[model samples]
Target chain A: NAGVIQTPRHKVTGKGQEATLWCEPISGHSAVFWYRQTIVQGLEFLTYFRNQAPIDDSGMPKERFSAQMPNQSHSTLKIQSTQPQDSAVYLCASSIGLGEDTQYFGPGTRLLVL
Target chain B: QQQVRQSPQSLTVWEGETAILNCSYENSAFDYFPWYQQFPGEGPALLIAIRSVSDKKEDGRFTIFFNKREKKLSLHITDSQPGDSATYFCAANQGGSAKLIFGEGTKLTVSS
Candidate 1:
């Protein structure tokens, strides 16, 4: 299997610009998750979706961050007017279902906001 | 509220030595715990996991000792090698959710 695939493995964006990251989950996987990893905050849970519907997004910043699961095979996380503080590796993972299943992760998209 | 906490921001150990990384959790509902290993520039992978019902789980040289009552657990890597050097993270899941709360990763360096 291809596991999970994330696009633009590395991205550099100027401050105040928008950046969009994409994820294509494994075939037949119904659940997708997003996380932000930084040296200081570690791995922070950003959001999750099940069956193309959002389940939890409490960890996402209310102002500038948004995620969408428009179809079963893909999802996207977009940050508007990114700041230097937003620089971090964005990770996407997928699983079969919501209960106790192992999550297969993608290589992740590293965002560097200048 | 940070449900999980891990200790020793970083550790260095010699080959053939054992390295123990500690973790504690605050959520009583957490029933599943898993350890993940991540190399540079890659996503974290599952190392080994333990359910709250079990006190210990072992896979090859890696072991997880869990204390459900104390809400604490640990990962022990026996016979460490230089290739084993990476960041280890402890994660927990409550009974109802599939979401995992991760701890601040512990970086391990195994020297020759």
Candidate 2:
């Protein structure tokens, strides 16, 4: 199996520019999640989707962040007007269903906003 | 609010020694606990996991000790090796929720 796949392993954007990160979950997995990792914040949950429906996005910043999973295969996280504070590794993970299932993760997209 | 807390932001241990990392969660509904290990420039991978129903789960040199009442857990790496140096994360899933509450990672360094 290919595990999870993330595109543009690394990204660099000028301040105020927009960035979009992509993720392809393991086949047959029904749940996908987005998380941000930084030295200070550790790992913060951003959002999650189950069966192509957003289940929770309370962790996402209201104004600049949005996520979508149009189909079972892939998901995207978009950041608008990106700031230096948004420079961090964005990780995507997937599992068979949820809960106790082991979440397999992708290598993650490293976004560096300058 | 931070729902999960981890101790000792970093630790250094001698080779062949045991490294113990602690974690505590605030939510009682968290029934699934998993520990993830990540090396620099790589994504986190499941190291070991334990359900609330069990107090301990062991795989090779890694073990997870979980406490339900105190809402605490610990990951113990026995016979640590330099290869084991990485950031360790403790996470919890509450009531079948897809989201995982993660503790600030603890970086472990095993030196010869």
Alpha carbon deviation, residue B33, candidate 2 (Å): 0.7
Per-residue lDDT of model 2, residues B1-112, tens digit only: 7899998899999999999999999988888889999999889999898989999999999999988989999999999999999999999988757788899989999999
The residue-level lDDT of candidate 2 at A113 comes to: 99
Q: Score the docking of each candidate (DockQ).
A: 0.83, 0.88
Give model 2's TM-score for chain A to 2 decimal places. Answer: 0.99
Model 2: residues with Cα > 4 Å off, grouped in runs: none
lDDT of 1 at B43: 97
TM-score of each: 0.97, 0.97
Q: How far in Å is the alpha carbon of B55 misplaced in model 2?
A: 1.3
For residues A1-114, write the lDDT of model 2, one tens digit per residue.
999999989999999999999999999999999999988898999999999999999899999999999899999999999999999999999999887888999999999999
> Once model 1 is optimally superposed onto the true structure by TM-score, how far is the C-alpha of residue A79 displaced, in angstroms?
0.8
Across the candidates, what are chain A's individual TM-scores? 0.98, 0.99
The CA lDDT at A98 in model 1 is 75
Q: Report, for every candidate in turn, its global Cα lDDT versus the true structure.
A: 0.94, 0.94
**Count of backbone clashes, every candidate in sequence:** 0, 0
